[model samples]
Target: MIRGCIKTITCGKKLSRNTKHSNTSNTGNSNRHLPVYAKVAYILGLRVSPSHRRMGIGLKLVHRMEAWFRDNGAEYSYMATENDNLASVKLFTDKCGYTKFRTPSILVNPVFAHRLTLSPKVKIIHLTPSQAETIYRRRFATTEFFPRDIDAVLNNKLSIGTFLAVPDSATWQGTDHFLSDPPKSWAILSIWNSKELFTLQVRGASRVKRTLAKTTRVVDKALPFLRLPSFPDFFRPFGFHFMYGIGGEGPEAVKMVKSLCDFAHNVAKERDCGAVVTEVSGQEPLRFGIPHWKMLSCPEDLWCIKRLGEDYSDGSVGDWTKSPPRISIFVDPREV
Candidate 1:
């Protein structure tokens, strides 16, 4: 019987850069003394039947996947799981030699019937694909887990567009010298339409709870002005917009990030999406700028990584597990 299964994908590579060690837990420097870039693979959707528990099937599956990753030129392999998943934690860390690498938080905000109000002084400008690609390559190339095929991601059909949020007083100078003379306080983010790819449904809801949810939706629709806090109809398949490449600069950057999030919320509402979602590094200061409901947000999403190859061609990669936290992370929308 098919009791266990695992999947892997070569997402991209991490740049080799000198990183400072932080006192924070779980955030690490991905590359310390490695080559210019190291290829990386991601493992996901590992499953083993409950009846086959403790049979080592999960471990075997992970080993097989690691072999495949190594064969495909991946130097590092990583996977994500909830912090409370003890079984997964043990299998990956204790048995598989994977280290607890990063702890990023998944932030989710439901699309409310009422549109979010954007600051009158904030102006959002949509950037073309080429323009967006240039900015990402120049600014975030050194970021950990940054995809080498960023142009493909920006040009993908699912990507709605890349947007820049700045004060109305900021002037546009195109992409030519924007980076050198960037706005004092500005934020940028890209939106991916996950609806066309797949939808999510919340199963096993109590009958009473389901009825209450439906009732709330009805009331909110009838009286939109109430701006009632109502849950989306998760009993059915619903879609969401994922925001990625979220970062900013200057003192007002935090406010700009919030403005961009509000703008995304409105766009999701317009698309009839159930929610707007994003994931940011746990220690990321900008995390406070991304609005999310505490009830819907995940405090810590654990990511475990393992060095696939034993051959250290040019000295050790320096233990990434001991690396420090970075202020910003480039979350690949394709992963979502």
Candidate 2:
């Protein structure tokens, strides 16, 4: 039963997505944060009230939301669903033309949700709202999720929600995130009773490059990840290089992937996962060079770009001087 929204903006903040919601609320109220970037407007918690069943309310909402996102500055609008969900699958993929990302996984924990092994020098801790805003200015030049700007590693709120990374594994260090107020950046680990599925999706990616010392490792040493014994034929673990659109150089993106790999490993170990997977498409210099993890699925998931209207070209003057890795993460919809 998707209903009203409660959007908010920060003081002197450019766009207003710094909005928060309450248990009594249904959706975000404003589009202040949305007008700022080439964004994705996903209709979450889609449902049907008793009288609304089979009334096309869900489909109509999708059309309405898509229209709103387009009206606001979103270049692409998106959403996802499980393959078994016939109605959702048909609505988004078939009717709306939303493409499905590969390599989906569900993570679970009997006692807790994840594991963390953060570096001693780079202490992992949670951030307050003010701290998050400050960090955002440092991390992103433009185009951000407002909240995603903060370092999830130390944010306690991220943990209760979901985030963990193990950097400098030689030192046995890592970070974690929770989904509560003032999110958790240091909930070290959550030992699970059984195995959990670790999944990654590439919502967007482009080519990038940078220089790494020969001795410098790119993949983080910790993350609860393991390649499943068998992969479905249609699966193709896609990876994208995002440094291009974001305007960061290649080396920076490489460093980021290395950190993410470490986090992935820590997550796998905590939840007893079996593998880490990523698909590299159209190998460019940046897409190459990094260590190739095992490919659980094929590498033929062709990404077809369809344009509607307006200035489809991204405005960038400089070229990527170096090549780094391309990696985009997708989802881990908790069934809990």
Candidate 3:
């Protein structure tokens, strides 16, 4: 008998969801067929008490979730976990037949006391919830777990704002920059306020590691020129700016990415945030463009997937047993 349970989101057409995160509303169309964008099932907050461990309860919960997913219109079901979690790895792959598919690089960059000059060719536009949702739907259609209701993300108190970096047009000359010429590309950045969502307590550092952290902070304060890593206070309540739904392409892709990073960093600093973070697939072309701490990030998050059915048009479900050329990654802000 299962004493514990796992929560699952049906991902109805009107529901807003992302990989590892789903915020569902009562659509009253639960019995309707899955919408084109609602073919995914996100498993969230699975837990079993320690006393119930080693009794197959966890596996049973996942099995139940998968069944629920199939009964809905989910063609694929997926979740994210730490790479070092051996127990979850075994349970998902060995027992449940889920395949480990994507490993995206989660990079963290500190919010330093520096402001970047907005590029003359580009302007950052703060988008309203409706505008952000409409633009995101068209721009990130292929991205995995993209929320159908972007308003949920933008309206949340934890969200700072959704911004778009586009060319400074003839009619709209940006305040910081002129419209001498417009850039050929654009990008959207959604910043999530991690401090407001939940508290983070990062522990388990060794003595030497802890000492090094303190030393770096001292050096940063004293020298100010050496530019050592400025580690945030993990013990206290500090804010984090998580940038998500980054989109850009073409020759101007690199420039767009850099501007977006700078924009996010400046916003974080303004809000007294400790760090800025974003995740991208290892194969992302714009990966090198975003600013990040090199040694701090090395793709430690493991993305596992299970195909509930055979439709692969949306690219959320893939043949992970045989390696595909490119893997799709959709990092939901709620999942962060």
Candidate 4:
């Protein structure tokens, strides 16, 4: 019988900078000017039988996976887990040499019985894949961990579409000239439908809670005008729409972002998605614009990463864990 198993996937390259240390022998100019990319891999679903605990099987599995990553030309490997998972934290950080890299929060907003209203003054424009790709590449190329294969992502069948929200008063420039002269206040986001790929279910709810949930759903359905807050049947298999590449600019950008989020919620309701979700860096400013429930969201999702091979001493490759949080992150929807 199989005692344990782990899964790994090679994500696309990410833009990163190499910190120049004085002790490095090379006198070449700082690698900052030249763009440096690291081929990244993600480890997930590591499992071991309870009876085999503390037998070093977990470490062996990690080592084997790391070897495979290096063989596949992965320069960096990372994994995400709940912040409270102490065992996972110890194994990856203490035993596997991975360091805490990023703390991004998973924001989840459930679809409600009543449709969310968008502002009359805010107009949302759907962008074609080509247009979306151009904007992402030009604006977010320098963002930390930006995927190199962004074109593929935009073209993927699961990607619904990318959208831009701007004040209706702004003169609408053609899509081609958007980069040159952007609107004064604007927000952009993309949606990925993951229902066909996978679904989620909630377990271990008490009988009383389940009854209360069912009653609430029934009442909400009967009286939607009341706008009672009712949750979907999370006890069963349910899928969600993921919003990614969320960003905005200008003083009124926050309102634009909120309008976009309302639009996404309405779309999710039409598609029968249980929730609309997105992950943003802990320090991201635009996060305030995204609407989510505190009880249903993860406030501190942990991502740990480590460099592969003997190039650990290379000063040209900066320590990603120590990178500043000010730079925005592009959460790859494919990884979801």
Cα lDDT of model 2 overall? 0.33
Give the lowest summed-lDDT range of ten residues in model 4.
Answer: 1-10
RMSD of each: 5.9, 15.5, 8.9, 6.3
The digit string of per-residue lDDT tens for model 2 on 1-336 reads 553221211111233334433333222222223223233344544677868677778878767766766676555543434446677777666666666543222221111123444334222332344443333333232322222323332242322222222232212212112111112121121111112322333333332211221111122222224322221111224222111111112233444333444454455444434433333333322233223333333333322111223455442311111112233221211211
lDDT tens digits, residues 162-241, model 1? 99998999887887667767778888899999988999999999999999988888888888888787788878999999
TM-score for each candidate, following the candidate numbering: 0.86, 0.37, 0.73, 0.86
TM-score of 4: 0.86
Rank the models by TM-score, top first: 4, 1, 3, 2
Off by over 4 Å in 2: 3-37, 112-148, 151-311, 314-336
Query: Model 1, stretches more than 4 Å misplaced?
Result: 1-36, 314-317
Candidate 2: worst-modelled 10 consecutive residues by lDDT: 239-248
Report clashes for each candidate as comma-separated counts.
2, 73, 0, 1
Assess the local accuracy of residue 152 in candidate 4 as a C-alpha lDDT between 0 and 100: 86
Question: What tens digits encode model 4's per-residue C-alpha lDDT throughout 1-336?
Answer: 112112222222232245433343221221223334566777766888999999999889888888888787776788888999999999999999999888999999988867777899999999999898877776665566677778888999999999999889766566656666678789999999988799999999998999998888888889988878888888888999999988877898888999999999989989988999999989888888999999999999999988786665444446555665644678888878
| Pairs in steric clash, model 3 | none
Give model 4's clash tally: 1
